[model samples]
Target chain A: MSEDLRERFPEAEWIDSHDQDVVRIAPDQLLEFGNVVHEAGFEVLADVTAVDWYRTRTPRFDVVVNLLSMQHRRRLRILVGVPDGDPVVPSLVPIWPGANFGEREVYDMFGITFDGHPDLTRILMPDDWEGYPLRKDFEVGAVPVQFKASHQVN
Target chain B: MTDKTIDDPEIEEVDLWVSGTEEAEWDVYSTDEGAQKMRLEETGARLTEQLGSVVTDDYDLDDIITEDERMIINMGPQHPSTHGVLRLQLELEGEMIRRSKCVIGYLHTGMEKTAETLTFLQGPTNVTRMDYLAPLHNELCFSLAVERLLDIEVPPRAEVIRILMTELNRIASHLVAMATNGMDIGALSIMTYGFREREQILAFFEKTTGLRLNHNYIRPGGVAADLPPGWRADVSDICDTITGRLTDYEDMLKENPIWVGRTRGVGVITAEECRAYGITGPTLRSAGVPWDLRKAFPYSGIENYEFEVPVGEHGDVYDRYRVRIEEIIQSVGIVRQAADAMPKGDFRIDDRKVTPPPRHRIDESMEALIHHFKIFTEGFRVPAGETYVAIESPRGELGCYLVADGTGKPWRMHTRAPSFYNLQALPIMMADSVVADTIATIASLDPVMGDVDR
Candidate 1:
């Protein structure tokens, strides 16, 4: 499967495989590459999520997908970069209905936009929710901390 | 109409409709399973059955009404049976439920969003809290995914420990399911027995991981600590107690007629639907599907163990209960085998970045102290790549989809929570039943809101 990914997506890069998700490609190929992977065998949507780089990352947003193919028993990971300014990527909802809430999650967290998602509104937070809370730059003081004043879990 | 709770047995609004004239009233839906046709009562209190199962042939004429009305009602943010903080909008026929649409997101804590801010090593701490009942399984999946990204192998001792803790946690989680499901079913004492056994395992977790609940013991390279003194005996004690207690639970309710009536043929989900919905773990096994990740993918040296995947013959709620009971016995066996084969070696990988130094060395050497300090503070970095690791967790296949940008923190963290896939079948199961059956159906799904809402 790794060799097949390399051969098919020659322009795309295969970076690593964590547990089962073989990570490949970049931000530029997020949509097309995802379509290609869907065509391969991965039928389930799995999940779509993001992580913040604070400042060290190149594009600042790491977009990811977990795809499972029950027929082949293989899982694929697709990761893409979203630059700071636009933070936009095409939605995979047209292909998978499960991506509905997950894509909205990315939008609400890292301020990433899912271009063509049917309903890209907030799912977790309030409809009038402010700035993305999951961004590296987003401050955590929007809500008061009352759990503890002295001890932090970390 | 949008998202309402479909409750009540009396069909007033949906069944009968009265127009401009009070005399020209037509009945819409009946509670009968096979009665077909229309009933025009001046009052819109009852409907004819073409889609429902309430017997309408012997309709009581005592409560005849002169007026007709319909209503759409919403239930829950406080209702626990919706599974989480799920909201449902129902279209009603008087007291009879007509249609229901669900609204979720009342319990979402944004854990997936928060995972990106912390380092990859810090990811497990965040993920485990999502599914409180199955925390160890959460940590295992995330750590394994990270290890796979680094392409590093953990020591034999570490692998054994991981398998031991994870299988035990699976049993513990299933116990919570049995306990709460029993409570929902009115078998109150069964809950206490389940919790009693669960506490024994929780004590073992506290012994090794310091924290009892979210023990991030299963790190990328290996476990956080070596096997503590008397760890083997402690685990064996719990397993033995659980083995004995399980039979007692069977004696309490297995043959009881009330227990049989509630679950025998209720919530019958066929194996084909289980496949279509992509359900896993006990739920799928209960539906007669053979698709466990341990048997199919066999990660973290699960191939080394001698255990059988217990499956249910019927796709009913009763079969699901039996499958979980059998799984507890099997998990006990796996934990015992792993403990018997525990190796005398290092508990983590040799890589300094992923694994910390020996405890004694920190007191004697400056390099070891510095490494410990750095590991505790900045954490370790992984090669820029993405990975998704799926393990057979108690509820189902708990998989961690991680994207690492060659930094100490993760780029993106996505959890493939079983509740999400398993909950898809709720509408199918609850459609033909009475409102009272709602409690049983939700309990049978055995979902944790944290897993669902996250």
Candidate 2:
């Protein structure tokens, strides 16, 4: 599967980070690459998450997807670079129906849009929530918690 | 609701008395309460304006219903059988469901957002609250992710202890599932019997970790402490007690005609549907997919343990029940073997950077004191990298993905909560089933809202 991913997209960088097969693909090729991986027997789309590399890297966000091959007992990590402005990636919902809530979550937390997601509404946050709470610059909004001493009886 | 609570004289709010001063009076509400209310209102207004365009144009109940005569109803944010705070919008044709949508985030606590702020040493403290029913699994997953990032090896005894503790927690969690499933299905006696056996396991937990639930015993490099004296006997007794009670559960529910009738053919989702929905644990196992993480992706040396991955032939509510029952027995066997072959060694790694010095050493040596103080204050740093660690949590394959940026705090932490994914199967399962069967479908999934909303 790793070799096929490399052959299909010559631009894809195969990385070996943290004992898992990590592949960095372009944002544009994400949907196509996912199709190839699915065809290569990676049946389980384990998780989909993003990391905010705002100041450290050019393409500010890294959208990470973990895939598991139950047949071969193997796993792979696919990372796609998404920039800050117009941060959009093709949706994997068409390929894997399981990415529905996960893509919605990435959209909710990081403000990264998945273009073809069926229902691209917020999953974890309220519909009216303003900022992406998981972004690096986004403040962890706090409410004042007043501590009042309890009274005692004799 | 407000009128009844305020009008009832028996429901008066408790009065407060200050302890320090002679006046001994305390006002529960702050004097600036009005200002606080105003700020909250402003925040609400701003949110409404930002999302106004999208919220109004979102999915309509009219779109899901096939005909104008079809009825649309809200199942619950507070429904008893929907499990914790899960609201379902059901479009029904008579009593049969046509299409359903699950509305979640009622219990959202932003645990992943919170993990970035806490140091690696404190990360487990936050994640453990995610799965309140199976907290040890949450802690173990988070700890394993951190340990993988740090590239540290745990002591042999600590690894064995972790397996032992997590297996016991799996049994306790499944018992809660059994209890709630029975209560949801109207078998009231099973609730009492299940909790009665679960309490014995919690007693063992308290004796070992000094807490009934959410024991933060497992740490990044190793466990927090060694097993207390006579823990072997305590665990042995717990296994024996629960193993005997397992048969009682079978007798009550296994062949009972009503139980069989309600669950046998209800809430059926084929193995293909389960895979597409990314469901795992017993729900996936009940569909005849033997894709358990313990065997597929062995972490923390689970390969050494000998156990069976119970699978069900028919992927119905009854099959899910049978799978959980068999799992409890297997957990008892694993615990017995672990107790008999408990290794003799340190409970934590010897690395001073991760694990603290001994209490006696801290008193005798000045350097040891400073090292202990520093380790507590500024935690050990991890190299810049990212990793994903998964374990066979009670619900499913609970996974933790961690990204470190060469600092004590994590760059980003995301938990692949099994319940969050498993709950997605609700709409699939609810389609074409009767309204009464919704309760059975939900109880079979056994999703904890903490795990879902985290």
Candidate 3:
């Protein structure tokens, strides 16, 4: 199946990660690639998430989508890289409505915008949230434990 | 509506037409005459204006009604029937619902962010809390992903133990679902019965995992420990007790007229809709798609077990209930089979790099002591790679996506929570239904808010 997809979309970079086939595509071709895979009988968009590689990798974010073909009982992972400056990818909601919440979550966590989503508002964060929490640069805010009696350490 | 005008000293005319239009201003009346004139000139202009010029004969009922008559209300971030912090925005025309939107994220605690700091061994402790009802499955999914990345296999005894514990967890989870669905639909007695049955299973879980809810027992290498002594007798007791009580539950609610009337035809989702929405587990099975991960894509030697996947034909609320009930029985059967075929060997993997040395070995050998110390303080480093592993939980397909950067701690760890995906189909199920049935439908979906918001 990976070989078939590789032949069809020659531009895609197929990386074999721990025996799982990961097809990395550019942001612009996401919708077309999604349509092709949908036509190929990947009925379910199982999950959508993004990983931020701050200062370590070139294109700062990789939006990962897991697709399941229930009829054939197969799974496929599709990755689209979004540059730090312009973190926008075409939404897969048209091909799979199940991608709606997953895409919203990716947007909420990584600050990547899905272009054609119906409602692109934050789903897992407050509407007035300041920054994306899941980004590598985002600080894991830690609160100091205040001792009741301000004791001095030796 | 007029009584509000008389109460306050700063009295103003109570415009019942646009009462709560303060927030969503788009629903308010447009004062622009040019736009109104354009709408008047084109007969289908109103349809085009609302729907982007795609004029069709089948117009929405909301399009015909004035905005004043159509009420939009928030069901909960607090209502009892909402299951947890789930809030629903319902667009209503009298008692019937025109549309509904599930407003989630009240319980988001940034667990995924926290998982990045935790090691592969500590990953289970975090993911286990995602689906509190089925914590073992969450741990199992995470452990499977970590094991996949590490390229190691657990002992045969460990695999059988995992299947045994997870199947039991499935039964306990379905019991809670049955209890809550009954409570929402006004069958209060069944709620008590369901919990009473589940208590027995939880007892068995407590005996094994130590904690009741967040049992961080299943780790990357294997389960935390071997099965407790006398587990066979306890398993037999639980199976026998649940089997007897299920018949009692069937007698009370299965053929009852009120139960049938309330659930028989409510919240219908077809097989195609289930696929499009990524619904799975009992909900998908209720739609008559017998696509179970344990059966289709067997993991952890589950294919070795003999069991049947029960499916429902109608895909209604009743069908979901029926599917869960039947699933509980099948889970019991699997548990019995696992206990019968329980293998005897080392519980966890033998790799010293991943699995810590046993307590006896640590006391005897200095090298074993250092290995144990190293495993705990710095944790084992996994080869840099990424993998996604999914297992069937009670609600749906619980998945774990793990990425390693050749460090003890994970680079990124995310759980594909089943409750999160299943909640996406709630609006489709609740559309065009009466307001009262909304509670029943949400209960039927069996979403755990911790799982949804995480």
Tell me the tens digit of each residue's lDDT in model 2 across B257-337: 999998998777677767766788999999898878988888777888899999998889999999999999989888888
Worst 10 residues of 2 chain A by lDDT: A141-150
Worst 10 residues of 1 chain B by lDDT: B45-54
**Candidate structures ordered by DockQ, highest first:** 3, 2, 1
Better of 1 and 3 by TM-score: 3
lDDT rank, highest first?
A: 3, 2, 1
Q: What residue runs in model 3 are displaced by over 4 Å at the alpha carbon?
A: A1-4, A142-154, B1-63
Query: What is model 1's DockQ versus the real complex?
Result: 0.19
lDDT (10s digit) by residue, model 1, range B254-302: 9989988898877666665555445667878987766689987888899
Task: Give per-residue CA lDDT, model 3, range B221-316, as digits (tens).
Answer: 889999999999999999999999999989988999999999998988888878887889899999899999998789999999888999999999
Q: Is candidate 1 or candidate 2 better by DockQ?
A: 2
Worst 10 residues of 2 chain B by lDDT: B33-42
lDDT of 2: 0.84
TM-score of each: 0.77, 0.88, 0.90
Clashing pairs in 2: A151-B17
Full-model lDDT for every candidate: 0.74, 0.84, 0.86
Q: After superposition, which runs of candidate 2 have C-alpha atoms over 4 Å from their true positions? A: A142-154, B1-68
